[model samples]
Target chain A: MGNLLRFEWRKLWQQKSLYICFGIGLAINFLALLSAKNFGALDSALGNMCVALNSGYTSFLGIYIALYACQDSSQQTIKNIYARGYSRSLVYWVKYAVSLGVTLATALLYWGFNFLLTCCFGGEVGSFITAVGQALALQLWVIIGYHGLFFGVAMLLNKLGGSIAINLIGVDCVFVVLSLIISLLKIDFNVMYYNLPNLLTDIVEASLMMPEFTSSMVLRGIIIPVLYVVTFVGAGWLVNRRRDV
Target chain B: MNENRQTNYVITTDNLTKVYGKKTVLDHVSMHVAQGDIYGFIGKNGAGKTTLMKLLLGMSQPTEGKIELFGSHQLNLGRAKIGALIEAPAFYQNCTAYENLQRFAILANAKGQDLHALLDFVGLGNVGKKKAGQFSLGMKQRLGIAIAMLGNPELLVLDEPINGLDPEGIKEIRDLLLRLNREQGVTILVSSHLLDELAKITTRYGIINNGRLVEETTATELMQNCQHKLQVLTDQPKQAEKIIKKMYPQVPLLVSESGVEVIAEDIDSGAINRALVLDGVNVRGLTAITDNMEDYFIQRMGGNNG
Candidate 1:
C-alpha cells in the first residue's frame, strides 16, 4: 500500500495536466483581481477571493481530477498496477487518497495565493485572513466532494474527453435540470442548497458577510458533501473491482 | 504431488475458464510451465492467450477452476515473484522511459535497482528524457520489458512482446529473452503469432486453439513429432512397401492411403526409388516430406490435409 501510494504520487506529479490546471486557475484569479476597479478594497478583493477559491478553483480541480483519474485507463496502464499484484480495492483507495490530498493541497495553494494577492494589493489584511480562515474548511469539503464526483465519473467512463466533459458539464446540467423541476413544481424545499456547488456558494457568501451559520446549515454543508464523496467513490471502487482493466 | 515437480513448476492452472456474457473465451485450460523453461503460448487472434495471462496475473478473475503461481494457490503473494507484460506494453505516455520504469519499480518495491542498467539491458540506455508517448512501438516494448525486469522477477510473462519490431528488433528481443532465461533463470510464458521466432527460443510449448489447450509438448518431442519423412508412391503398393521395408530394415516404415512412408532421419529416397523401380514395381513418384512447427500447429488446430 505504501509503495502503491508513492507510485501514484509520483505519477500524479509527473502529469503536465496538473500544472496546467493550476496555472489556468491562478491566471484567471490574477486577471480577475487585476481588472477589478476597486482592486485595493479589502472587502471586494476578499469577496472575489471567496468566489475564486470556491467555484473557479473547484472547477479547475474537477478537470484535473477527471484527467488524473482516467489516465491509467485511457493509456491502458492500470494493468501495470494490477499486474504488480496489488488488489483492485487497494488501487482504488490509494487513488482516492491521492486525489483527496491533491484537492486539499490545491485548495490551500489557491487560498494562499488569494491571501498573498489580497495582502499585496487590497486593504486590511486582518479581515481578509479571517474571512479566508472561516471559509477554508467548508471550501475543502466542497472541492473534495467535487473530486469524488469527478473521479467516479472518470473511473466509470474511463475516457479522457468523456470524463472531463461529464465532470465539467454533465454534472452541472443535471443540477440545473433538477433545480428547474423543483422550481416548476413550486416545492418549498430547496434541495439544490445541499448540492456541492450551492453549498460552496453559501459558504463563501456567509463567510464574506460574517453571518452565523445555523447548526443545521453547518451539518448539511459538511455531511451532504461527505455523503456524496462516500457514495460516488464507493460505487466507483465496487465497479472497478469487478471490471476487467 | 511429488516434491520435485512441485518445486520445479513455476505456473500451473487447472480447468481455468473465462466467460464473457454468452461467449466462453477460455474453456478448461490446464497448463503447466516449469521453472527455467521458456514456455511458448501459441494461439491465433482471439484464442484466449491474453485472457489466460490476465487470469494468471490476477488482472481478471477466473470464472471457474484455479491458478497456482510458483507452486502456491495464494496468487497475489506468489505474483510478487512474477512480472508480466500482457498485450501491448502500457505505460504513462507522458512519462519518460526512465520515469515509467521508476514508477513501476516503485510499485514493485524494487529498491536499489539500477534503472539505467535495466534500460541498457533492454537496449534503451541512451533514450534520456524522451517521453514514452514519443517512443516507437518497438521502443515501448523494450521499456515494457525493462519495467517487467524490476525486482528480478523469477518468471516473466510476455504476450507478443515483439509484435511491432523489425527483423533486427525481433532478433534483439529474442536474444534478450534468451539471455534472461539462460543467465537469470527466469521462466518465461511468451505468446506470439510468429511461430518461427518462438520456435527459435521455446523449450516447451502450449498450443491453444479456440480457447482449448490443443497440445503441450517439449521441444524435443515436438521436433520428433514433426520429423522428416520419405513418401513413396508406386503402382504396386504392397510390393513397394515390402521392397522398401526389406531394403531399409532399420528404418521405420508405415503404409498410408497415399503411399508408403519411410519415417526416419536422413532417409535416402533415391536408393529406395531405384530399389523399387528395379524390382519391377512401377514408381509413380517419390517425394521428401517434412513438417515444421507451422505445419504441426496448423495440424493441431485441425487444419491437417494429410
Candidate 2:
C-alpha cells in the first residue's frame, strides 16, 4: 500500500498539469491583488479570488489530478501494477488518496497565497483570518465532491479525450440542466449536496462573501458531494473490476 | 492437506470463453502451463490468442470460464507475481524509460534493486534516461518486454511480444525469453505468429484459430506428426519427378513445379540421392525439409491450399 501510494504520488507529481494549475492560480491571485492595491478594494478582491480558487477543487484542477492518477491503467501499466501481489481494491484506493491529497494540497496553497495578499494590501488581519477559515471548510467539501465526480469520470471514459469531454461538457450539462430543474420545480429536498455538481455550485456561492451558513446551502454544500463520493467511487470500482483494459 | 494443495502448474484455465455480443471470441478454451515451461501459444490474427491472455491477466472479464494461477485460482493470484504484455505496448509517450519503470515498479509492488536487474534482463540497461516517447517501434517493443519483467514475476504472459521488431529485435527478445526461462525458471506463456521462434524454445504448444484450440501438443509430438520430406531443386523438374517416382514408387511425394518433395517418412537421404544419381536425374540440390509450426497449424485448420 505504501508503495502504491508512493507510485501514485510520483506519477501525479511528474505530470506538467499540476504545476500549470498552480501557476494559473498564482497568476490569477496576483492579478487580483494588483488590481485591489490600485483601486483600494482589497477585502472584496480577496473574497472574489477565494471563490475562484476554490473552484479549482471542483472544476479544472480536479480533472487534471484524477486523469493523471489513472495514467498507469491508461498506459497499460495496469498489468505491471497488479503484478506485485496487492489486491485491486488497494490499487484503486491508493489512486484515490493520491488525487485527493494533491488536490487538497494545491487548493490550500492557492488560497493561502491569495489570503496573504489580502493581508498585505490593507485588509484587517482578524477579518482575513475568519475568511480564510471559511474558505478552508468550503474547500474540504468541494474537493471531496470533485474527487467523487472525477473518479467516476476517469474510470468511465478510460481515455484522455473522453475524460476531458465528460468533465467539461457532460458534467456542466448535467449540472446546468438539473440545477435549472432544481430551481424551477421548487422541490423540497433533504440532501442537496448529495449531488456533486450542485454541491459544488453551492460551495462556490457560499465562499463568495460572508461566512454565514443556511440549512439548504449546508445540505447542498456538504451532504450531496459526500453522497456523490460514495456513489461515484462505488461505480468506478465496478467499472475498474469489470471493464477491459 | 497443505501438501496436496501445492501447484505444479503456473497457469490453469477451465472452460474459458469470451463473447462480445454476437461474436464469440473464445469457445470453452482450457489450457494448462506447467511450472518452469516456456509454453508457446501459436495462432493467426483474430484467433483468440490475445483474448486468453487478457482473461488470465484480469484486464478483461471472461464471459464463461475460470482461471487459476500457481495452483491457486486466478482470483487469488496476487498482481505482483504475474507480469504480462498484451497487444501494443501501452506507454506514456511523454515520459522517459526511467520514469516509466518507476511507475511500473510501484504498481507491481516490486521491491528493492530489481529495477536495474529488470532493465538488464531485457537488454534495456544504460538507456534508462531516453524518453519512451522517442523510442522506435522496436525499441518500444523491447521496453515493453522489459516492463513485463517487473517484480520478477514467476509467470510471464507475452502476447505477440516480438511484434513490429526488426530481425535483431526479434532475436534479442527471443534470446532474452529463453535465458529468463533457463536461468530463473520463469514459466512463460508467449503467444506469437512467428512459428519458427515458437518451435525453437517452446517445450509445449497450443495452436488456436477461429476462436478454438486446434491442438495442444509437445514440440516433439508435433514434429512426429509431420513427414520428413526431401526438397529437391532441379532445372528439369518434370524429368526429375518421373525419375524419382520410378526409383521409389512407395515414397509419398508432394510434387510442385519447381521440384518434387518426397515425404519418405523414414528413409536415408543418401539412399534417395544415390538412386536419383543412378537415374541420371539432374538434382540440383537436396535437403531435409521438416514440418514446422505453421504446417501443423494449417493442417489442423484444414486450410485446403494443398
Candidate 3:
C-alpha cells in the first residue's frame, strides 16, 4: 500500500497539469491581493480571499482528479498497479487519498501565502484569524466532499471529456437546477440548504460575519459533508472493484 | 498437486473460455507453456491472443475454466512472479523512459534493482530526459521490454512485442529475448505475427484460429512430423504411377495433373529413376520437398488465414 501511494504520487507529481493548476490558483490570489491594495480594501480582503480560495481550491482539485482518473482509465495505466499484485480496492483508495492529500497541500500553501501577504500589506488580522481557523476546519470536510464526489464521478465515467464535464458542469449545476426546481414548485426540501457545496458557501459567509463557532455549527459542518463523501465513495468503490481493467 | 508440480509446466489453462455478450472470443483454449521454453502463440488478428494474455495477467476474468500460473491457480500470488506487456506498454507519457521504469520498479518493490542496467539491456541507455510520448513506435517497444524486465521476473508474457520494429529493431529484440531465455532461464510466452522471428526463437508453438487453440507442438516434433514428399514430373505420368506402385507398393503416391507425388519414409531418386526407366517411362523432373514452420502453420490453419 505504501508503494502504491508512492507510485501514484510520482505519477501525479510528474504531470505538467499539476503546475498549471497551482499557477492558476496563485495568479488568482495575486490578482485579488493587487485589487484589494489598489482599492484600499485590505480590511475585508482576507475574508474575501478565503472565499475565493475555497472555490478555487475545490474546483481545481476536482479538475485535477477528473484529469488524473481519465488518463489512468483511458491509457489503462491502472493495470500497472493491479498487475503488481495489488487489489483493485487498494488502488481506488490510494487514488482517493492522494487526491485529498494533494488538494490539502495546495490549499494550505495558497492560504498561507495569501494570509502572510495580507498581513504584510497592512490588512486587519484581529478576530478574523479565529474565524479563518474555524472556516478552515469546516473547509476540510467540504474539501473531502468535493474530492470524493468528483473522484467518484471520474471513476464511474472513466473518460476525459465526460468526467471533466461532469465535475465542472454536472456536479456544479445539477444541485442548483434541482434546488431551483424545488423553489419554483414550492417544495419544502430544507435539506437542500445543507448540501456540501451550498453549505460551503454558507460557512464561508458565516466566517466573514465572524459568527460564534457553536457545537451545533461544527456538527452540521462535519455531518453533511461526511455523508456526501461516504455515499459517493462507497458507490464508486463497489463499481470499480468489480470492473475489468 | 504433486502431479502439477512434477510436470514442470510454467503456465497451463484448462478449458479457458471468454465470452463477450453474445460473441465468444476464446472458446475452450487449453494451452501449456513449460519452464525454460520460449513458447510462440500464433493467431490472426482478433483471434483471442490478447484476450488470453489479459486473462493470464488477471486483467479480466474468464467466463469458464481455469488458468494456472507457476503451478498455482490463484492469480494474485502467481502474477507477482510473472512480468507482462500486453497489447502495448502503458506508461506516463510525460515521464522519461528512465523515470517511468524507476516508478514501475518502485511499484514492483524492486528498490535495489539497477534500472540503468535494464535500460542498457534494451538498447535505450542513451535516451535521457526524453518523454515517452515523443518516442517512435520502435523505441516505445524497446522501452516496454525494459519496463517488463524490472524486478527480474522469472516468467515473461509479452503480446506482439515486435509489432512495429524495423529489421534491425526486430533482430535486437530477438537477441534480447534469446539472451534472457538462455542466460537467466526466464520462461517466455510471446504472441506475434512475425512467424519467421518466432520460428527462430520459440521451442514450442500454439496456433489459435477462431478463438480455439488448434494445434500445439514443439519445434523438433513439428519438424519431424511436417510433411516430406518426393515430386516426380514425367511423360506418361499415369504409366509411371502404375509402374512405381507395382515396384514399391509401400510408398504412398498421389497423382496430380502433370506428375505423381510420392510420400514415403525412405525416398531414393536414383532407384525410382532406374525403376521408371526400366518401365520405359521418361522422368522429366524429380525433387524432394520438406515443409517448414510457415508451411506447417499454413497447412494447420487451412491456408493464408495468418
Candidate 4:
C-alpha cells in the first residue's frame, strides 16, 4: 500500500493538467487581489480576498479533480496498479489520497498567495489575525467536501468531460433549487442554511464580515462537510471495488 | 494435489467460462501452460484469447470454473508471481518509458532490478524524454514487455505483443522472448495470430477456436500432424499409384485427379519416377508439399473465420 501510494503520488504530480489547474487557481486569486488593491478597499481587502479564494477554489476544484483524478479511468492506466497485485479497494484509496493531496495543495497556493497579499497591501494582521485563521480553516474543510464530491462523481461517471459537466451543472441545480424553495417559503429552516453552498457562505461571513461566531454555526460548518466527505467518498469506493476495470 | 500441480504447470484453468448478457464469449476453456514452455495461444479475432488472459490475471471474473496460478487456488496472492500485458499496453501516455517503468517498479516492489538495464534489454535505452504517447506502436509494445519483465516474474502472459510491428521489430521481439525463455527459463503464454512468427519461438501451441481449446500439442507432435506428402503428377495416376502401392503396401497413398500423394517420410523420387516410366505411366511432374504451422492451424480451426 505504501508503494502504491508513492506510485500514485508520483504519477499524479507529473500530469500537465494538474499544474494547469493549480495555475488557474492562483491566477483567479491574483486577479481578485489586483482588483481590490486598485479599488482602494484597503480596510476590507482581507475579507474580499477570503471570499474570492473560497468561491474560486470551490468552483474549480471539482473540475480539477474530475480531469486529473478521473483521467486514469479513461486512459486505462489504473490497470497497471491492479496488475501489480494491489487490490481494487487499495487502488481506489491510493487515488483518493493522492487526489485529495493535490486539491489541498492547489487550495493552499490560492490561500497562501492571498495571505501574502493581505499582509503586504491590506490592514494590519494583528487586527484580523483570528478571523484569517478561522477563514483558512473553514476553506480547508469546504475544499475537502468538494474533493470528495468531485472524486465520487468522477469514479461513477469515469469520464473527464462528463464528470466536469455533472459536477458543475448537477451540483449547481440542486443548490439553486433548494435556495429558491427556501426563499419562496420564507420559512425559518435553520438546517437549510447549513447546506453545502449556504454553509460555505455562512463560514466565509462568520470569518470575515460577521463580528461574532456562534457555537452551533461553527459546529454545523464542520460536521456537515465531514458528512459530505464520508457519504460521497464511501459511494465511490463501493463502485470502484466492484468495477471490472 | 497441490504439489503435483505446482511441479509442472505454471497456469491451469478448469472449465473457465465468461458470458456477457446473452452472448457467451468463452465456454468451458480448460487451459494448461507448462513450466518453462513457450506456449503459443493461436486464435482468430474474438476467439476469447483475451478473455481467458483476463480471467487468468483476475482482470475479469469467470462466470464459472476455477483458475489456479503458480500452484495456488488464491489467484490474487499468486498474481505477484505473474507478469502480464493483456490487450494493449496500458501505461501513462504522458510519462516517458523510463518514468513509466520506474513508477511500476516501485508498485511491483521490484526496486532491486536495474531500470536502465531493463530498458536496454527491450531496446529502449536511448528513448530519453520521449513520452509514451509520442512513441510508435512498436516502441510502446517493447516498453510493455520491459515493464512486464521488471519483477523477473516466473510466468509471462502477453496478448498480441507483435500486433503492429515491422519485420525488424517482430524479429527483435522474437529474439528477446527466445532469449528470456532459454536463459532465464521463464514460462511464456503468448497469444498471437502471426502463426509463422509465433512458430519460430513456441515450444508448445494451444489452438483456440470459437472459445474452445481445440488442440494442445508440442511442436514435434504438430510437425507430425502437418501435411507431409509427396505429390507425383502423372498422366496415368491410377496406374502409378497401383504400382507404388504394390511395391510398398505399408505406405499410405492417395490417388487424386492430377497425381498420387505418397504419405511417407523417406521416399526415393528417382526410384518412383523410374518405375512409373517403365510401367508406361508418363510422370509429368513430381514435387513435395509440406505443411507448416500455418497449415496446421488452418486445418485444426476448420478453415479461416474470414
Candidate 5:
C-alpha cells in the first residue's frame, strides 16, 4: 500500500494536465485581483475573492480531479497495476487519497495567492487572514466532498470526456433541477441549504458577517460534507472492486 | 498435495470459465504450463486467449474454476512472481519510455533492477528519452517487453508480443524470448496468431479453438503428427507413379501438380531416383516436404470445427 501510494504520487506529479489546471487557476486569480478596485472597498474585494475561491475553484478542481481519476482507465494503464496483483480496493483508495491531497493542496495555494494579492492591493491583512481562517474548515470539507463526488463519477464512467462533462455540467444540472423542484413544491425543508454548493456560499457569507462560527453552523458544515465523502467514496470503491478493468 | 509437490508445472487451471452476459467467452479451459517450457498458446481472434491471460494475471476473475500458479491457489501472492503484457501494451503516452518503466518499477518495488540494462536488453537503450506516444508500434512492444522483464519475474504471460513488428523486429523479439527462456530459465506462456513464429521457440503447445483447449502436445509429438512426404518431379508422371507403386506397393502414392508424391516416413529417395532413371524416366527433381505449424494449426482448427 505504501508503494502504491508512492506510485500514485509520482504519477500525479508526472501529469502535465495538473500543471495546466494550476496555470488556469493562477490566471483566474490574477485576473480577479486586477479587477479588485471595481468592488469599491478593500474589505469587499477580499470578501468577494474569498467567496469566489471557495465556490468557483470547484469548477477547475472538478475537471482536474476527474482527469486524474480517469487517467488510468483512459490510457488503459490500470491493467499494469492490477496485473501486479494489487487489489482494486487498494488502488482505488490510494488514488482517492492522492487526488484528495492534491485537491486540498491546490485549494490552499489558491487561497494563499488570493490573500497575498488582496493585501497587496490595499486590503487589510488581518481581516483577510481572519476571514480565511474562519472559513478554512468548511472550505476544506466542501473541496473534499466535491472531489469525492467527481472521483466517483470518473471511476464509474472511466471515460475522460464523459467524466469531465458529468463532473462539471451534469452534477450542477442535477442540483439545479432538484432545487427547482423543491422551490415549486413550496417545501418548508430546504435540502439545498445543506448541499456542498449552498453550504459553501453560507460559509463564505457567515464568515464575512459573523465574528465566530456557531456550533450549529460548524456541525451542519462538517456533517453534510462528511456524508457526501463517505457515500461517494464507498460507492466508487464498491463498483471499482468488482468491475473488470 | 503431494502430487502437486512432485509435479513441476508452473501454471494449472481447472474448469476455468468466463461468461459475458449470455455468451461464454471461455468454456471450462483447463490448461497446464510446465516449468522451463516455452508454452505456445495459439488461437484466432476473440478465441479467449487474452481473456485467459487476464484471468491468470488477476486482471479479471473467472466465472467458475480454479487457477494455481507454481502449485499454490493463493493467486494474488503467486502472481507477484509473474509479469504480463496482455492485449495492447498500455503506458502513459506522454511519458518517456524510461519514465514509464521507472514508475512501474517503483510500483513493483523492483529496487535492484538496472533500468538502463533492461532498456539495452530490449534494444531501446538510446531511445529511452523518447516519449512512448511518439514510438512506433514495434518500439512500444519492445518497451512493453522491457517492462515485463522488470523484477526478473519467474513467469511471463505475453499476448501477441510481436503483433506489429517487421520481419527483423520479429526475429529480434524471438531471439530475446529464447534467450530469456534458455539463459534465465523463465517459463513463458505466449499467445500469438503467428504459428510459424511460435513454432520456432515453443517446446509445448496448447491449441485453443473457440475458447476450448482442443489439443496439447510437445514439439516432438507435433512434428511426428505433421505429414512428411517425398516427392519426385518427373517428365513422365504416370510412369514414375507406376514405377514407385510397383517398387513399394504398400506405400501411399499420389500424382500431384508438381510430381509423384510418396506419403511415407523414411523413404529411400536415392534408390527411387536410381530406379526411375534406370527405367528411362527423366527425374526433373527430387525433394522432401514436411507440414509446417500453420498447416497443422489450420488442419486442427478445421477438424475441431467439423
Candidate 6:
C-alpha cells in the first residue's frame, strides 16, 4: 500500500501540468486578493467578508482543476496504474490523497490571501481567521464531492474535454440559466436535486455571504454533496469494474 | 481433494467467453501456458487477443468460464508474479524510463531493479534523463520490457510487444525476451500478428481465430504435421495446385501474392517443373519452401477466422 502511494505520487508529479496548475491556482488566489488591494476598506471588507466578493472566482478551479485531474484518466494512465499490482480501491485512494493534497494547498492559499487582504483593509485577523477557516473547511466537502464526481465523469466518459463539456457547460450552465428563469415565478427548484451542483454553489455562497451565518448551514449544506460523493463513488466503482480497461 | 486439478502450469483457462450486449466478443476459448514454456498466442487483428489478456489480468470479467493463474483461481493473480504489457506500452509518458520502472516495480513491489543494472539490460543505460514521451518508439518499447522485468516477474505476458517497433528495435526486444526466458527462466506469453518472430522463440504455439483455439502444439510437431511446399511461380500454377492436391489432399495448397505453394511431400523443384509443364503450365520459377512456423501459422489461422 505504501509502495502504491509512492508509485502514484511519483507518477502524478511527473506530469509538469500538476505543478503548472498548482502555480496557476495559487496565482489565481493571490491575484484575487491583489485585485481587492487598492479598494481600500471596502475591498478589504469584502476580502474579510465570509467569501470573496468575487465568489465566482472559486469557479475557476471548477474548470481548470476539473480538466487537469481528468487528464490522466483521459490518457488512460490510470488504467496503467491498475495494471500495476494495486487494487482498484488503492488506486482511487492514492489519486484521492494526491489530488486532496494539491487542492488543500490551493484552498489554503486562497484562505491566506483573503486573510492578508482583510488585514490590509483594517479588518481584524480574528474575523478573517474564523470566516476564512470556516469557508476553507466547507470547501473540503465540496472538494470531496467534486473529486468523486469528476472521477466518475472521467471514468465513464474517458475523455477530459467531453467530461468538462458535460459537467461544466451542460450541467452547471444549464442549471444556472434555469434558476435565473425560474426566479420570476418565485419557484425555487434550484435547491432541488435537478440543480444539485448549483445548490452546492449556492450553499457555499450562502455559507460565506450570509450577513449572519452559522456553522449548521455549512454542515447541512454539505450533506447533499457528501451524498453525491457517495453515489458517484459507487457509480465510479461499478463503471470501473465494467469498463474495458 | 483433487490434486490433479492443480497442475504445474502457471496459467490455464477453460472455455472462456465474453459477450457485449448482442455481440459475442470472445467465444468459448480454452488454453494453457506451462510454468516455463514461452507460449505464443497467435491471432489476427480483432481476434480477441487483447480481450483474453484483459480477462486474465482481471481488468475484465468473463461472461462465462474461468481462468486460473499462478496455480490459483485468483483472477487477480495475473496482477502479481506476472508482468504484462497489453496493446502498447502505457507508462506515464511524461516520466523518465527509470520513474516508469519504479512505478511498475512498486506495483510489482520494488523500488527499482538495481536501476543501473536494468538500464543496461534493456540497452537504455545511456539515456540518463530522457522522459518516455521524448524517447523514440524503439526506446519506449525497450523501456516497456525493462518495466515488465521489474520485481523479477516469473510470468510475463506481452500483447503485440513489437507492434510499432522498427527492425532494430524488434531484434533488440527479441534478444531481450530470449535472454529473460533462457537465463531467468521466466515463462512468457507473447501475442503477436508477426508469426516469424514467434516461430524463432516460442516453445509452444496456441493459434486463435475468432476466439476459438484452432491448434495448440509444439514447434516441432507443427513442422512434422505440416507439409513443405516448393513455391513455384508457374503460368499454370492453378493446374499444378490441382494435380498436387489430387495426389496429396491433406496438404492444402497455399497461394500468396508472390507464388503458389504445391503442398506435397519431398518434391524437388525438378519434379514440380516437370509436372507443371506436362500439365500444360509454363513454370517461371521454383523455390523450395522451408517448413517454418510462419507457414504453419498462416495455414492454421488464415482462413479460419472467416
Using lDDT, give the best candidate's number. 5
DockQ of each: 0.73, 0.48, 0.64, 0.57, 0.66, 0.37
lDDT of 2 by residue, A1-245 (tens): 78778877887888888777677667766786778678876665356545655434354665585568567766776665554455567778888888888877877676677667776776654444454455557657767777777877787667766776676667667756776787788876533335455555555566654566565665555666676778888888877776676
What TM-score does each prediction get for chain A alone?
Answer: 0.90, 0.81, 0.90, 0.87, 0.90, 0.72
Top of the candidates by DockQ: 1
* lDDT on C-alpha atoms for all candidate structures: 0.84, 0.73, 0.82, 0.81, 0.85, 0.69
Residue-level lDDT of model 5, residues A48-80, one tens digit each, is: 555656535877887888889988998889998
lDDT of 3 at A175: 77
Which residues of candidate 4, in runs, are more than 4 Å off? A43-53, A126-138, A177-195, A209-219, B1-6, B243-253, B263-288
Least well predicted 10-residue stretch by lDDT in candidate 5 chain B:
B297-306
lDDT of 3 at B90: 84
Write down the TM-score of every candidate: 0.90, 0.83, 0.93, 0.88, 0.89, 0.80
- Candidate 4, residue A45: the lDDT equals 45
| Cα misplacement distance, residue A122 of candidate 6 (Å) | 6.5
Question: Per-residue lDDT tens digits of candidate 4, residues A22-80?
Answer: 67867877777777678866535456546755656766777777877677777776766
What lDDT does candidate 6 reach at residue B217?
Answer: 89
Q: Which predicted model would earn the best TM-score?
A: 3
In model 5, which runs have C-alpha deviations exceeding 4 angstroms? A37-39, A44-52, A127-134, A182-189, B1-3, B230-288, B303-306
Candidate order by DockQ, decreasing, is 1, 5, 3, 4, 2, 6
Binned by DockQ into CAPRI classes (incorrect, acceptable, medium, high), candidate 3 is: medium
lDDT tens digits, residue span B56-136, model 4:
876777899888887778777777877888878888888899888988898778988999999998889999999899998
> Higher-lDDT candidate among 1 and 3?
1
lDDT of 3 by residue, B34-148 (tens): 8999999988889899999888887887899898888876777777777888877887787899988988998777889999888888889999899998999988888888878
lDDT of 1 by residue, B141-203 (tens): 888888888999999999999988989989999999999999989999999989999999999
